[model samples]
Target: MYRYDEFDQQFVSARVEQFSDQVRRRLSGELSEDQFKPLRLMNGVYLQLHAYMLRIAVPYGTLNTRQLRKLAHLARTYDRGYGHFTTRQNLQFNWPSLEQIPDMLRELAEVQMHCIQTSGNCIRNVTADHFAGAAADEIVDPRPYAEILRQWSSLHPEFSFLPRKFKIAVSGAAHDRAAVRIHDIGLQVVKNDEGQIGFTVFVGGGLGRTPFIAWTLRDYLPEADLLTYCEAILRVYNLYGRRDNKYKARIKILMHEAGLDTVRAQVEEEFERIRGGVLTLPEGDVARIRAYFAPPAFESLPAVSLVETQTAARDPGFAAWVATNTHAHKVPGYVSVTISLKPVGGIPGDASAEQMEAVADLADAHAFGEVRVSHQQNLILPHVKRDDLPAVYRGLVAAGLATANAGLVTDIICCPGLDYCSLANARSIPVSQRISERLGDPARQAEIGPLLIKMSGCINACGHHHVGHIGILGVDRKGEEFYQITLGGSADEVSAIGDITGRGFSSAEVVDAIDTIVNTYIAHRASPDETFLAAYRRLGMQPFKEALYGNA
Candidate 1:
């Protein structure tokens, strides 16, 4: 993880005091609610339907044990006993009091964390692959670039107040775990024919009322020009992106309205103007940032762990967990573990303070004192020794975090809908909970194979429902909660928005509808090995549509 320097410490400390004064002014009636709105948003505070929500950025989803422990402390002291991990790999406290937020910010600052740029129409947290350095197929770790962007964009005067909020994601692996295609700016690390590293740049990708898979802006962007190219894109968006209506303010909308060719021309022109300027990343600076993310000291061991094999043979539960939750690592005898937050019938991403502390302890003991927050609302121990699998599994089981449901139907990505967000039309968490319960059986999940079910409360698409294998959107129909389903959505390398399956269903009918879809896939799939996504793509939506609505 990148340690905060003295400058970072001083900057965060100053911002804490600055925001503390603002909060005090609001409480003292010196600032009215309308006046405090923008100020609070700039600091990552939101006045939700029930209470104030605080979103703390976990840059590139990296966290050390110290930071994790600090978050646990915040969850225990400041807000409710639990905190919500979001789709952006950030953490949210939904019930924090307005006055206590300053204290929370101070606590976060102590751990080199903050909520800046978490909200508002600015470049939000720069995200990367959760398994960046450890992934077996990574061309390079993307976190260093993400950190560089963070340093460059924080409080940037030129791009601070864009037409709308912008998000950027980077993926280093050939397999797109970062969902880069659905970001405002997506950078996929690629190696040229000469073996020089660079990026395949994609722009205008986003999800909301309107969704788009980012168009390719550059086939190969030199590694040195990363910052310059990003700046050029932002400049183009800032100048011409829609500002009159919030609905059409995103860069994706600009791409839709202005056409990709025109936008490409404009970006190319801006790139030429600023290509060799101060924003150009230097080799020395890149090396310096890259050093901060060097691999941990790993010992030589057998490629396969006999201890893990023996333990799994003894414990079927551990065996099932290993099958579902672990990923192949770059280093032999090691694996990345996904700690599923979506336990059957529980809230998707809610982790209690005690669970947070337990994970911190596990990271210290099993991992290299490091933790990663996955965009799928899961925690990841990115480098765990295969030999220590049993102990790690035991700790997770004790903490109730051992739900062997990674990438399964039960591993749902859902947002806090009407329960927390004022903008929500209907409840999302309840629907997710019901679906999880319906498909909670481990055997059933294994049979269904890899499937992603994402739900959003409204069109804001906070839950990333647009990219799920099965997407659920909650809508308010005549004062009653109704749910709509979209099939064949995917967030991987071949990203696509889902297709709606005819009319909406009542809340009571939504879970059954999902069950029907799953059963239809099971029956129609050529074999058990065929994934829900692959089968859906092969068979198309007609079969599922017919199963759901029966030929109109």
Candidate 2:
């Protein structure tokens, strides 16, 4: 994790003081709701359906035990005892009072975290692969670059207010776990033939009412020009992106209206103007940032843990958990463990304060005192020793954080729908919960193989439903909640928006529809080895649609 310097500390402290006064004015009636709207948004405060929502940035999804403990304290003391981890790899406190937000901000500042640029139509939190430095197949750690972007873009005068909110994701691994293809700007770290590191830049990728996979802007952008290239793209978007309609203000919409060639030409022109300028990243700076993210001290041990093997032989529960929750690590004797927040029949990403504290304690004790928030709404101990798997699993089980459902049907990605978001058309959490419960069986999930089910309450696509293997979108149809299902959506390296399976289903019929779809996949797949996504891609929507509508 990148520790904040003097400048960062001072900047955050000053912002807290500034927002404190703004909040005070609003509470004192000196500032009306209309006047405070932008101010509140700039500080990551949203007036939700029931209460104020505060989104705190977890840069590139990285956190240390101290920071995690602070979040748990905030959730316990300020909010209703739980916090919602979002698809952006951020955390939201749903019940924080407006008056108490400044205090919360102050606490976060102490831990080098803040809410700035979290809500506004600016460059939001820069995301990266959750397993960045520890991934077995990473070309490089993308978090250093993400941290650099954060430092550069925070309160940037040029991009302070864009046509719409922009999101950027970086992936160092070939697997594309960061979902780079679905971001406003996606950077995939690549090595050239000469073994020099650079990025494969993609632009115009986003999901909403209109979804798009980002077009490749540059097949290879030099590592030194990362900032300059990104700035050039932003400049192009800012100058030409639509400002008339909020619906079409995103860069993705601009890419749609203006052809990719034209946009690329414009970006190239801008890059020519700004290349090798002040924004050009220096080797020293890159090295400095990289040092902050150096790999932890790892001991030499066998690749396979005999203790873990023996324990799993005895305990089928642990065996299942190891299969689903643990990921391969770059280091031989270590693995990344995903502590699932999505228990069957529970909310997808909501973690109680106690759970947060428990995770913090476990990270401190077993892992490297570090935790990562996955975009899939799960917490990861990114460098856990294979030898300590049993003890960690036991601790997680005790804390009720031991749900072995990572990348499974029950491990859903969902937004705070009609329950919390005023923009939502129908409830999302309930639908997600119902689906999870329906497919809660471990054996069933194992049989289904790796599947991602993402749900959004509305077209805002906050839940990233557009990229799920089974994407569920909730809509209000004649005062009744209905869901539109999309199949074959994926957020991996070969990213594609899901295809809608004909008509929307009533809330009552949606879960059954999902079950029908799953059963159809099971029956149609060549073998159990074929994943739901692979089967859907091979078979297409006709079979699932026929199964759902039944030859209507």
Candidate 3:
């Protein structure tokens, strides 16, 4: 976790003061909704379908126990009893009163958190892999670079008002867990043959009315040149990205019009001029930032052999959770555990106030007081000893935080659609809940195997439906809710945008449609060994389409 420095502290505090004044003005009627819109957006407050939704950034999704506890407090005291974790790994409160927002901001600043850049047409939260510093295959921690970018871009003069919101993601591991390819600007940390750290930069990747996987702009950019290179890309987007039409204003639209080669050429030209400019990071700045994120001291312990066997034998629920939620750790005898927010029939990324507090307590008790909010909308205790698994599982189960589904069908990633978002055409959370209820059986899910089922309110792809093996996009059909399904999408090493399988399914029929697809895969797969994604890739959408439509 990157600790807030003096500059960060001052910036957030000052912004809170400013927003407080703005909120007063709005409440006093000096500022109308039109007049106050931009100010509220800059602070990450939105007037949603039913109420005002406040989105607070959890930069790169890393939080300490203290931070987690603070979030819990906010959910309990200020708004509803729950907070929704977003696909970007931030948290959103669905029903905050307009006047209470400033107070909330002040409270968040106390814990070194803020809602800045969680919304607006600027560089939003710079996301990274959830296993950033702890991944076994990582070459280096990506958080320092993310933090550096955060400082440089926060309220940047030119970028503060862009044609549309821009997103950036970075990854240090060989596997792209951060979904770097789906962001507007993606960076993969790499080392050259000379052992010098740098980045593999990608541009024009985004999902909305248009979807694109980023094109690699540069293979090996020196670490010192990161800011300079990133500046070049943003400068290009800001100068020429469409602004006349909000729907077609993202960098993806520009990439479509200008073509990838021309856009790359423009960015490269800008990079050449700014390579050694003031924006270039100071020597060893990365190391200095990294000091704040140094890994917690871990203990040397042998693997808990008896504990593992006993857990599998004694508690089938714990065994199921371990199978899906526990991940490989860099350290021996330590496992990273995902605390699933998507319990059967619950909101996909929501954590109740009590659940948040319980997670914080568990993190402090068994995982060295650190926690991570994953891009998949789950929480991670990144360094738990294998011996402590049962105890942690028991605690999580007691708190209603233990669900065995991590990457399963029921573990769906969905945005707060029509229920909360002003831009949505349909309600995503309810749709997700219905799907979970329909397929709530653990044995059924295990039979289905590993699958990524993602849902988005619209083409904006907030829930990243573009990369889901079974992607569901909600749309408006003459005042009725309809969902468009896509198949064969993936967000791994071999990333691909899902192709639409057929016409949209009615809201009532969507869940059963998905069940049909899953059952079809199970019945027709070469073997149970083949996962949903594997079978989809090998057999393509033909069989699944046949299974769904059934020869008209």
| TM-score, every prediction | 0.99, 0.99, 0.98
Local distance difference test, each candidate: 0.95, 0.95, 0.89
Give lDDT tens digits, candidate 3, residues 59-114: 88899999999999999988889999988989999988988888889889999999
How many steric clashes between backbone atoms does each model show? 0, 0, 0
Candidate 2: residue 286 Cα off by (Å) = 0.5
Q: Give the per-residue lDDT digits (tens) of candidate 1, residues 168-222.
A: 9999988999999999999999999999999999999999999999999999999
Kindly report which residue stretches of model 1 are placed more than 4 angstroms away from their true locations once superposed: none
Error of 3 at 209 (Å): 1.1
Query: Mind giving the per-residue lDDT tens digits that candidate 2 earns over 129-151?
Result: 99999999999999999999998
